[model samples]
Target chain A: MIHRLIYPCEQAAKLSSRAMEQALTMPERVRLRLHLMMCERCTNFSRQIEFLRRASRKIPEVLENDAD
Target chain B: MAKYLGARFARCHETGITTRSISTMAEDDDLAQSLETHRKYLQRYAQFHLRDPSLAEDAVQDTLVAALSQRDRFQGRSQLRTWLTGILKHKVIDLMRSRDRALPPDAFSLDQDNNSAEGAFDAGGNWVDPPADWGKPDAALEASQFWRVYQECCQRMSRRDALVYSMREVMGLSSEEICKKIEITTTNLHVILFRARQSLRTCISKNWFGTQHD
Candidate 1:
């Protein structure tokens, strides 16, 4: 059996939610940051947060201009 | 006596010159300049976070109006930006509440427990093992490109999915609260989140990575 070095992806996804909210405690934040540093998957997960935020911010202009 | 003198010298060395200048015209001028700077930043920040150009504009306007009307109440405890953001946060919440009535309850999931650890790995991380040559990609793409594609992709998602994605990923709402807001069961929430993530991944890969690879 392969020993997993990190938490499962679903847990990581859940963590991504907490990470975006800036809700993770300092120690948890540090651990997540460390995990992200070593893990491309987590790094991409973090980028997803940034991507979503950027996308959400753009909605106002689209909604305002009545543009598709 | 020499050691005592040496310790005294060290203590004196550690305590550098300390001068407390009385507040002056220059200090007041600097404060005024800082306040104006903060007001500008707060407006831009409000616009970014709220995502309704008009609501963002209104929130900032209200912030400025309130700040000006209550200028005398400005204490030095917090920076002006912090205070303005606090006010703007309340305004954003008010706006969301009003908008929430017309919108369906958010339906994103937060179910990490049911997956037999192995199944979760494929969706979460194990699917794409990084190459030894892999490094940070060039960040040279115009900021607008990423956001534009991202917005288009988000629009393609279901309303509930979009709302959950925005609330969880953008606004950072907790799963429990998002479930309550979106009016979905926990199981449904997980299903929504999973599907939303999958859709976003497909959209991003096709729009972003596929082009680069081609």
Candidate 2:
């Protein structure tokens, strides 16, 4: 049961994206935080996805033709 | 200043000069022309929701016409893109509602390419190819070419995933609202959102960040 608190990179990545839409359970949050502490790649993945969300909100403004 | 200009404009209308009317017509033309500039962007917006190019085009046409007719209602309080996006959202929903009735039995059938990223992970749920570091991603936000690449990556997603992802991200719908709109369970919505984000992250990292990403 204690090992369940240690999420793998894939589960950590999913939890990170899920965090954007909804709150995670306490154990799930702890698991994700623990995995992220040791995983540099998943940390980058989490940050990049948050950035993706921000960039997506700007799609309307960015899609316009500036040359026009 | 606007009131004085309106009073002068009223006199111009009462005088009925050919030059004044012609100039007014020219102003209308200019407005249409400026509105025309947004057509490509509007078409892309419609396509994101409608999923069919011809239908998207029709929706954009209707939106532009409605915008032109109701141009006075646009008080410039918000960004013009925001206002136009609001109008386009309505047009997209209306089109979707109408099309739903006439859709064939297989309208929602899955695409040939599932485009699932489930294979990206190994048996132990580790990334097959771990994510690359994207330094200063905010800088890419300012580059128009980067947007083109980003949109291309979005388009590469399967239709169902794209619809769900766009509804959540681009439309800014709440998770509950997106689940209701797409008729999916919250669990299913989370899975789709996860895949969509993962796919987009890998695509953007490869195409934009990782010069050496294989």
Candidate 3:
């Protein structure tokens, strides 16, 4: 029963990244949560992609200031 | 030349020029030159979102033309590049919309998720090389060097992937909006985004975060 609830790291990573753009379904959310609870690397992967999104928004300003 | 200056002066008075410097012509020349300086950077930026080189060039051209025509409105409150980018952003979006409408249904040729995992996973869908710890992410934001590295990683993506990624993340466009503009389904959009994020994560980890498993 517990095994069925667990998503592999690849699926967990995809769900975590997808969660940023759209709301995951209840089952997806639940399974991803369960997977994340046990998976340290996937949790870190989720956090890094979130960080990437936030960082990306500032790119225009960064490029502007880079001009001579 | 004197007749032209006289006409310009009369027009300036008629339009109620509030902040006219002594040499309006020279200032106009300077503004043109300055706008030209940022053209390459603007092209790079537009290409990152537009995917087609000609479309990107046309968008930048339209932006400069609009900027010059509305030179009076530039209050100099922001940097010149920032101001030009503000204009270019709109021009790029307008081009994207119009071009999407003009293209045939078969024009897009959106690739499937071909290189998504790129051997990151094994047959059982398990991680071949799992993600490593990235300490203190917020601190990296303060380092300009880190941003340069980030820019490099972004440039390393395929053109279509970069376009979709920039649309979603940088331009703050919604998934629905991107799907409509690019003529792609939400599922395909997710695949492109997933690939982009995965590649960027690996690049940043290898370059900036130092993949030392602690």
Return the TM-score for candidate 2, rounded to 2 decimals: 0.73
lDDT for predicted candidate 3 compared with the true structure: 0.80
What is the TM-score of candidate 3?
0.72
lDDT per residue for candidate 3 within B1-214, as digits (tens), equals 2234345546766786657665886787677778878888898888757868998988988888788778888989898887888788778877876866676756556556444457777767788878888877888887888986887898787656776888888877799988997678988888888888999999999988983322
**lDDT on C-alpha atoms for all candidate structures:** 0.55, 0.76, 0.80
Which residue pairs collide, candidate 1? B105-B182, B106-B182, B108-B189, B109-B189, B109-B190
> Residue A50 of model 3: what lDDT?
92
Tens-digit per-residue lDDT, B1-214, candidate 2: 2233345446655776455557666775675676766777888888766769999988887777777668788877877667788888767766776766576747544433442365878877778988878878898887777876788899787666777787788878799977776577887787788888988888888888875422
Who is ahead in TM-score, 1 or 3? 3
Looking at model 2, the pairs that clash are: none
lDDT of 2 at A52: 94
Interface RMSD value for candidate 3, one decimal?
1.9
Chain B global fold similarity (TM-score) for predicted model 3 against the true chain B: 0.61
- Candidate 2 or 1, higher lDDT: 2
lDDT of 2 at A64: 59
What TM value does chain A in model 1 reach? 0.70
- Give me the runs in candidate 1 sitting further than 4 Å from their true place: A1-68, B1-51, B69-73, B104-144, B151-201
The worst-scoring run of ten residues by lDDT in candidate 3 chain B lies at: B1-10
Predicted complexes: DockQ each: 0.12, 0.67, 0.66
